[model samples]
Target chain A: MTHTSSSGTVRKGGTAKRNGRGLTGLLLVSAPVALLGWLIIYPIFNAVARTLFTAGDEGLHFSLDTYQRFFTDGYALNNLWLTLWVTAVCAACLMAICLPLALYLRFAKSRVAAVVQGLALFPMFVPSVILAYALIRTIGPNGGVDLVLNAVGLPKINSPYLTPWGPVIGLVWDNIPLTTLMLVAGLGGVSDNAVEAARDAGARRFALLRYIILPQIGNAMLVVLSFTVLGIFSAFTLPYVLGPASPEMMGPFMQRTFSQLSDSRMAVTQAVITFAICACFGAFYVRSIAKNREARR
Target chain B: MTAHLSRRGLLRAAAASSITLAMPRIAFAADGFVNVYTGSDSNISDFWTNVILPGFHETHADAKVRVVDAGDGAGLRAIADRAMAALGTDNDPQVDLLEAFVPDETEGSIEAGLWVNFTEAGLAGLDMVNPAARQTDFDLPYRGSQVLLAYDATRVSAEEAPKTWDELTAWIHANPGQFIYNRPDKGGSGGNFVRRAIHEANGRDPRKFTLDNYSEAYAAETLPGAWDILKGLAPSLYEGGAYSSGNTQSIQLLSQGVVTMTPVWSDQVLQALSMGVLPETTGLVQLQDLALCGGFSRITVPTNARNLDVAMQLVTYVLSKEVQSKIITELGGFPGVSWDHVDPALRAKYADVIPATIPTFPAGDWDAAINDGWYRNVAPGIARS
Candidate 1:
């Protein structure tokens, strides 16, 4: 009876200790979870709810008219198309340019590589508005580029900086650093030994890259592409300052609809649409992270 | 038992200290201070900081004025949205006074009944204010501005400059990439130009468009001519027909000698001249046939304002001749009151650029509709090639 009582007492103590630990854990996580719910999740829920309902002559009723208007309005639809087109082009261009450069920086030990990497990263320090004005000064009429062309006895190249190409170039310049950094980190996961073995087994440079490097960094590429799309999709400053006024990017279009047009419902609908589109890429990002964690496990 | 009593005592002391700390802030809020929310445009905010507030402080030594710089358009909308959100709630609005361009800029809040009626408030300068400047009895006109064509006198002589809309078009065609105007939705000057163009193109009476209601059928019927006119001029605009984004950009292009002329606000031109953003050689003119749209800046007190009487007194002082003349002389803002009430010297100073007839802006909805239409019908027609 004494031995049995002693074991029973120890078991009770263990249960009480576990209860205390569980309470502490709950207290620690509850604050951040509550904060996230209040700040981010609550606002999103409110926006979506507001878009789905409307107050009319009778009372609050379910409606899809706002979303219908967003999809049907020619101007809004054109802007949506323009936003997608610009974002897709920018993402593809960024990957094409940054991937090779990132790979080179990953393997090359030369000082020139270091200098190139530093140069690629330099634009991250420059603010978008300042960078826009700088671009205007360089490519505007009779600007530095024109002066250079004039001195070299060549016809001045007409500036494409004020068109859709303007924002694309600016987006590419702004995103190179982050994309390269992510990609270079990703390339680190590719085993040097595997690359060497492939090369020794009669694999050429193209084949080695196709079989070894690209496959290893697929998750990283998805991550980089997803972020680039999100960044370009919601970008405001460069597009506003440099791009055509009509058929504007989603950011400026939403702003004008809300502030200039004073159509809050339409603005919210547009915002929800933008969020849904970005969420597609966001899903990929989340999946990549989950997969990465799974791979590590 | 002793430790328990001490802990309870400590808790009581902490609670008392917290209440004491919050009491002063509540008292300060009740101390009868006017909170003014104005646009962050340097022309508006700087004039208040450097002139109006200082002058008001001299007369009312005991009163305090706090100015908040809510940015233009988007910023003002944010403020209005916040104030509207607090409606029917227990919380009072944080703002007392709102400063904005009349009609179009303040329409959202006005429609929502966020502003108190100034006519019943017994404002001082109501009689002296220009009838054209009075949007309604509820709107108190504080300052005025008119859109005008600003040009580089060194590049184009006064005799060479276009004097009518038709002449201006011909001049643009002749000069190719030497003239520019911003997108209508971006700035009041550009919007004014677009409105004027629509009025001229349709051959409709400008007064008909000034009513508050917008008819979609009427706009659909009349907008094609305006679009056609805009399309024809696009190929001759600066940078191979791509218009600049905003008024400031057009001004920048002019300052850089990239363009010979562009539409700009008369008051902004004066401000830019003083700041050396525009050369002294820059000349201003109102087209003889087309009266450019002009309007007054409005000041309204919200219903939830803390110091309602003091806010009224502050606006009264702003409308007085001493302040009006100072605004005209320093900031180039036209008098909110009639010329008879303005100082004669100030009246003569801006005589050259002031229009004899000011064209009224279209209804708020029409203004937005026209801007949107420009983006839709007109912008796409511009030959990018």
Candidate 2:
């Protein structure tokens, strides 16, 4: 007890000074924070400013006409809603799929478990553009699935390509590796002894998961949900290739508006709106981190 | 995100330094050098490299010609913008020549003052050039292409194909799920298809709209009718109003037997056929009453080009009977000079696809507006179900 107390005392005060706790911490954080402000934050504010203010006959007049049009326009609204819907669906699906996979990877120590983890993480290596095209060839209409099915005497299948669900499938597939990684890292907190104790207390799979696993991994779940939302919301390539043409996702919509329509202001407005929504999703992760810090203190 | 950003930053820095390093190596030779800029595809570039360069080098042994392909006109646009910026200034524009782009005066605006006036310049081969193909004195029209209907002959007979816009609309209604066009913004075939539709709706007069006549009010009055025509045919498109995402996709759909007919560029379809990407049974036909839009690939010499004399000599050579025949035979395009000047065999071979007239479309503001408007109004008519 005396030895432990002395070691703890050494870690608390003397070590805290030697570690990057005060001026060193401030210096380290300031550089990145300042760079981020210059690169990211400044551009975001500038985009918002440009969208709201324009050069007209009156000279730098402020008008919400573009915003009004974006809000009122059915096409723009459809794109926004589609983006939102796809993000929500992708986030939910990621949680449902990844949570279980994470639990299995945590408990199952069999050699087969290593293979499963490798397969799940495979998408992390594949680029998103390649993944989209690979998905199209693998499951799209008149593609490999049809060829195999026809050989087996089955009816021609409806393809997900050029549909709203197309981006969702590609996104979920591309996202599995990261989501599973985060979730598995979260599952690390669920100690084997605790899980075993809960099970011996007559807690079945559901109860054990509900009480022990869920509580231990709440922060990880929050991180995954927030990240999935943020990642899927701003995704461009997959949706551009796989999604429908009309009610498309915001990423492609902004791009088409900027390059195709030759309207940079409109595109910037769409971008600002996209990031604004994503920033709200980011609040969840920030809050979870803060809560963990407070609990530690 | 940080890793991706840092890697991208490093790549951009490397690219900038490399481009700077290569900048000085561009031909600064006082004579016997001309850098030709082209926005054409690899096939056309290959023709320029293998056929045009070698032939020109044979005539002028000491001549050094470099053909640089600026993809999809972006590099051309940037060069033009740079030249325009350097106007009345001493900055070296560094560009020698542009192919497939024209520098001419817009009506009621300041004179372009960009290209050398070839008509007044009196090049040696001017007399042999076809009068009808010449767009303006600013441009030397060397080759031409048109948008035509590409159909699968396996399912569609030659007689069954429509020869006019109205007939085509009827054919689409009759053969539902067999016809599709790409999105107007994404592909030229779809853009030309929509262009012909606009012409058909507005009293069937291609002359009502001009390159200089576009205004907000004029478009407001003229575009609604066109939208109505496009929307009317929406339900009859492939997969119940589904539009292909691009020109290549539209052709891909036809090759996959998903659609029977699609609007395709003449040169692209010819190249694809030669490469055996498209089936042997694919047939092409141009509308008779009012053909879809096509343009002559005009070669322009910037008035301030470093190699103006050599460029003009090259132009005269390009306008020769020999090179014009190569334009038709080797390049799969129509000759700038009349069909009479080209080899009889090549002219006869292209009889079916030779356009009656190359109708032009307004490109500056009209293209973007038409594409955007289609997305807003006509695209919504496509039933997702």
Candidate 3:
């Protein structure tokens, strides 16, 4: 988020004097880079180091005991599997929901499109804790929905809160605005003239979408998927508050292991494993961005 | 001065990086003063500085006490270790008095005689304190809080409310979707409720479990039955076994009349009622068979305390009827002394919050095992997809 906003400012100031621009850019980049290395990279190395070595009867020796325990422990593996499943479902749901909204906001010339776009983006401003609390009150048992249903003579609604469905619903809802924005940006390349030409060539709506729109928006959708998967995989508050107790997402599972179980080593192991999985999506994102930059050049 | 400046500069850099550096509550710990280190939260620190210390000052005007906040008992343990190290050596531990200190926090503290024996000393007001509140001779308990069943009296009748763990389980089954407890790992209310379940499962005995009794094999044998008991009772809970996230949320559910019963702290419920956040009919009760767990704040002075005479004096003063009432009305905690020994008016006001007995569970290895097992076997009957 900081990167996007800072890059926007740099672009606005592009007409600055060309001489000493290298030094100027270096000065501008150094603070954030140094901060990231100190705050993020150092902690990552420390966590990984703690997991790779174990203090034993002999001495502080290199060992994989915690990683071994995590792999052999059915409970730990189940948590990992649940995290992956939630991330996958959230990614799928985000795309399925956001693509439609983005398309409507792009093509629909109605005045209501502005309202729809604003509604889609509103969740971005609401903090996740507030959003989760609102979701629980609105959908959980004997909550607002049940109150209304009872007043009108209907059965109580079966709540998704505390089920595996809970975090999925929350993550999907929370990620929609960003996903829509990204897909809409990608959709900018799908010109109306191109769609018109495709239609004039006797193409149906589905074919126009598949041939003209999807090809242009494919990279944006990938970016959205990669970011959503990474974010949802490591989310703590929503899963800790809303997800089921058993078979937890990795974020809550690692925290509970460290805090409740008082096993810091095991918690670090779980984190390293989670980081290894997220690295795949992260690598894909970086590579795609690099490839995009290369294509533009 | 240059070295001091560099140290302060480094500390500032670290403070700028981290969001919250727990600033010491009272900072002037000068030489020749009796240093008091307390391991309680800011509220109890305020209690010491405002209520207890001011009263002590009237008796000993010349003496000075400097208080330090040792967050969550770690500071007290660090002092105990320092005291242990200083025994028979020509070094000063520099720790004079401790509040909210647990003697068992450090290994060998008991055998090493690291603390002054409270019972053996026979302080002036020790006779007034409840015998049940005393855990060991090494520590003096001055304040306490218990988890009780917070219920809406309008929905659940006086006779209908549960008095025993078994009765509570039956009531939950009979009136499905009317009871709630927060997840065991989230709050003490639910954690103690789960501990009560474990006690019930293991032949209704609290003595079988001890601070040092936890083992993987023992937990595997004992906790499976507890998981079965909790899992069997889960379907009858509010919204088919959905637990509250914390003690406050559990009471929130009760306040909304969605749940008739939940475990809550005595102090919190009373405060909430006084604040008009909950209905007037909100009542608190304790389970009879084996009571829910509660935490007691105990003070332990080291055997080698420099101001041992003054420390003993302060203990007796804090235990007196006057301060004990302040414990109730001001601090919102139970008096370390019995109800009959405290101020009668304040006693009458807190009669509803008082329990016949408040048993506590240890929070170390056993706590971890029970909570982790609960998450694994009790909370989820649904298969992992």
lDDT of 3 by residue, A231-278 (tens): 899998888778776778899888777756667888889999999999
> Model 3 misses residue B323 by how many Å?
6.7
Fnat of candidate 3 is 0.44
lDDT tens digits by residue: candidate 2, A1-297: 332235565456675554644566699699999999999999988999999999998799898888898999888998899898999899888888988998999999999999999999999999998887787677876778888999999987888877888899999999999999999998987789999998889999998998889988989999999988989999998987788778879998997887666578989999988988999988989999999899899
The candidate 1 chain B region of ten consecutive residues with least summed lDDT is B101-110
lDDT of 2 by residue, B37-155 (tens): 88776778888888888888788787778888875444566666666665567766666778876663222112646678887888787777778877678778888878899999988
Task: Rank candidates by DockQ, best first.
Answer: 1, 2, 3
Name the best candidate (by TM-score).
1
- Give each prediction's DockQ, rounded to 2 decimals: 0.32, 0.26, 0.23
Superposed on the true chain A, the predicted chain A of model 2 yields a TM-score of 0.91
As a whole number from 0 to 100, the lDDT of residue A209 in candidate 3 is 84
The lDDT of each candidate is: 0.82, 0.82, 0.82
Give lDDT tens digits, candidate 3, residues B222-340.
88888888888888987777877777778777877788889987777776787777899987778877788887878888887767788888888899898999888877789998889
lDDT of 3 at B219: 86
lDDT of 1 at B107: 47
Model 2 TM-score relative to the real fold: 0.82
Poorest 10 consecutive residues of model 1 chain A by lDDT? A1-10
